[model samples]
Target: MEYSMLADIDTGEQSSQFLTFIMADEEYGVEILDVQEIRGWEPCTEIPNMPQYVKGGINLRGTIVPIVDLRQKFGFNNIKYITTTVVIVVKVLVEDKSKTMGLVVDAVSDVHTIAHSDINLPPQLGLDTGPRVIRGLVSIRDKMVVLLSSSLLLDLNQFQNIEQINEHKTQQPMATND
Candidate 1:
């Protein structure tokens, strides 16, 4: 379903709405404004020589949206894509350009309005996964939600490479084995 039309009417000065989802039993959230749509699990056209976390790309309308498996991206084992599996289509900004991609998650949770004060900055632990992807940590209904920075989640350098490869593939004709 298209979540693009969902308006952010939260007038609170220091609050924002986030669309939460589950992956490996952990709850994660992204700003609702960045969401384009929510889709059910669907097979995609697998691309060759891409990272393991990059599941592949799917044709959404006229655009070929790349899909990233969050579980694999987060160093988790591959699980079956059940009925609850969903793809959250999000728009991210990179170098002044807007890119659309889908994130494969276990299941979508809920949208919660979080006040600025409620979000706690993630600790500066000696870990690769830092503020680059995780924006902050918030608690909702006693559950901790890792707020994510969608733009940073898809690394700019890596994403540009994917786009370049996609463009090159489209411009070149397929080779025949005859």
Candidate 2:
């Protein structure tokens, strides 16, 4: 879906498209505008001293794109990557500029058109003042889809030294055959 699908002419409501995916049986979406591309699971050049969630980095043409597994990042049980596993390349706002990263998800579900009004603010669990990863929630097809604020999902500072990480690389095995 394109950003051109942002407005409904008849109703005059502002809406945006979301690229939805499934993880641990739950639906999650990232704004379509942030999506750069989707790719199949492939081994990446592993970096030393990075968090478990930071899978590694891949050479996208000439750019070294860091990959992150959402399941691991969100504290879900680790599972072997299969055919359904894919990497969604997205441009996230880091600091003031945009940075490209790959998010490893279970599988892509669909492209949903949701209106701005339909999105509900995420509840505050406690008095924690930490940055929020969830942007909002929306009901689509009678199921709740967690819309993620891509910009806040990853720790911006962790990737600031990407060039250094690229300097040290080894292939990491992430996929398996069952």
Candidate 3:
């Protein structure tokens, strides 16, 4: 999903856990259960014909995990990477299957526990964040947090594209140890 930069930590559901992060000077949260690991930024191999927000793919041990720049995806202005830059590796579920991907963020905020009743309904906006992208809003420490609908963050097409790229990479013939 193109992140709702104004968002905060939660599952977009009642009493859910979230891993909060910062992007484009805003806060966003994803389901903690979906998070695999958090790592610092590293250059990834660029893939041709992909969206600008898709920075590229990284070889995580053996899996080719696609890295998405939340800033660009959210249409944030040009930003320079700094020590706080990080990649939040998350296990995304697409069509009953799980795929690993990385979300690049300016920095990571803290995890927050959201009670079911505390979440406020989302306001109407014509943003690119599809209807299901944002779950709700809540106040924390007198700050508003935006909860994201983890399931709807990305559509099938993006995952399909990543899969195709990975398949293409694997199809390349290997050199013999002659």
Candidate 4:
């Protein structure tokens, strides 16, 4: 289902709307409704025996939220601190319920109002990353921002695994509690 938004663009009678951000020199966007908040990078509690792309979890207002590093997910070389680093907290529907997750990006560019007509489907060829996550492409000031599907971006399989692990942990009799 394609959700459309209003934008203020030079194109007369047609406008573009998008929430744009930067990751590894490329701009990307997600529907505004899917976004919950933009937060500065914070230390995350590491989860053992998980994928490298999964950068552990963060405490958001007393709730534990998992974070994903787009750079690692997209096969970019790991680098030390960069000033542009930020975490975008997105609310995604998982298993019929809304769940919040943090996406680590290089930086946030701007929230653009992208017209529906301005978006172009990404080419099937030569895409290093699989196209399953990317919905389409849109131009913003000579740069193309890949529009990402929040549902696909926040696949809950890993989280489900984490939940299983936690369930086992809880099932085990706690030395202190017992």
Candidate 5:
């Protein structure tokens, strides 16, 4: 189910709803407005010569939506896909274009409303995982929620590959008897 995403943080407004999901021991969230749907994990058509994190692409209706494994994306070991494994469909922005993709997560959690004041900036660690990817840190029910920045969800080059794959799929000829 989709919940309301965070409002403009710069404004320091009232509490905003966020959809939370579990990844290992940590909980992460994203704007609910950007979410398309939540679905059970399904096998996808593996693409050659793509990043390991890019699990593959799935046909959503008629659109080719790329699937991303967040565990692998965050440099984690491949775990067994269980009944809880699910794919969260989300729309992300890249270079003024909105692209739809599926994020393979362990399982989804509860939704909570957090005020802008509660969010704290993530500490700079000088690591390859840039701080820009994270929006901020917030505490709820004695747990810390790491908010993600949808704008920087994936690398620009990855989006290009996904777009190309989509175009290539659409350009293929349909088989029929004349």
Candidate 6:
């Protein structure tokens, strides 16, 4: 399921839906179907021996999910969090299977419907955040929002580790009352 952002845009209902979010001062969007829910920033239990981009896992609705700091993943200068900090839960498909993961962003923005015509290949000009991850751009309230590919936002190896952890937990036997 992990795919680098590409330029092609297909038509139909699947073409326009997106969930917008902010990181630092820039705006970005991911397909709405990929998003699970928006949550306020919560303390994450640090996991030893994991990538720095992996901010660790947090208990979400009684389920543990790994959180990733998009700011760091995009190579932006760190900034202090305010009340606006939020975690976006996205369902990512890996090896043809779906899995949930958390993305930390500065804030959540309005959802937008970007038509196929509005999407274009990212400019050849180099960008600080790396142009490879940008699928296209759309104008939102006089501000340009970069549309991102859901697959590129995550790392496959890390996701696999999350799946393994979940599997291990499930395999453990429960205590008997008797």
Q: Please give, for residues 1-178, the per-residue lDDT of candidate 4 as tens digits.
A: 7534553445454554557887777788887778889988877888786789889887678556788898898788776646768888988777887777888988888877766677798788865664288879887788778998877774677767656655675688757954
**Tens-digit per-residue lDDT, 1-178, candidate 6:** 7432233355343346788988978899988878989989887988667788789998767566899898988789887767999999988777787778898999998877766677877777654663256778888788888988776676677777876777777788998999
lDDT value for model 4: 0.76
- For candidate 6, list the clashing residue pairs, or say none: none
Q: How accurate is candidate 1 locally (lDDT)?
A: 0.86
Instruction: Mark the regions of model 6 whose C-alpha exceeds 4 Å error after superposition.
Output: 1-14, 125-132
> Which lDDT values do the candidates have, in the order given?
0.86, 0.89, 0.80, 0.76, 0.84, 0.79
TM, every model? 0.84, 0.87, 0.83, 0.79, 0.88, 0.82
What residue runs in model 2 are displaced by over 4 Å at the alpha carbon?
1-5, 127-129, 165-178
lDDT of 5 by residue, 71-105 (tens): 99888788988899999899887877888989899
For model 5, the run of ten residues with the poorest summed lDDT: 2-11
Q: Which candidate number would show the highest TM-score if scored against the true structure?
A: 5
lDDT, candidate 2, 1-178, per-residue tens: 4343489788999998999999998999999999999999999988677798999889987678889999999899999999999999999878777888999999999999999999999997786746888989999989999999888877866677685555554445657999
- Rank order by lDDT, top first? 2, 1, 5, 3, 6, 4
- Model 1 scores worst on lDDT over the 10 consecutive residues at 3-12
TM-score, ranked from best to worst: 5, 2, 1, 3, 6, 4
Better of 2 and 4 by lDDT: 2
State each model's C-alpha RMSD to the native: 5.0, 7.1, 5.9, 4.1, 4.0, 4.8
Clash-forming residue pairs, model 2: none
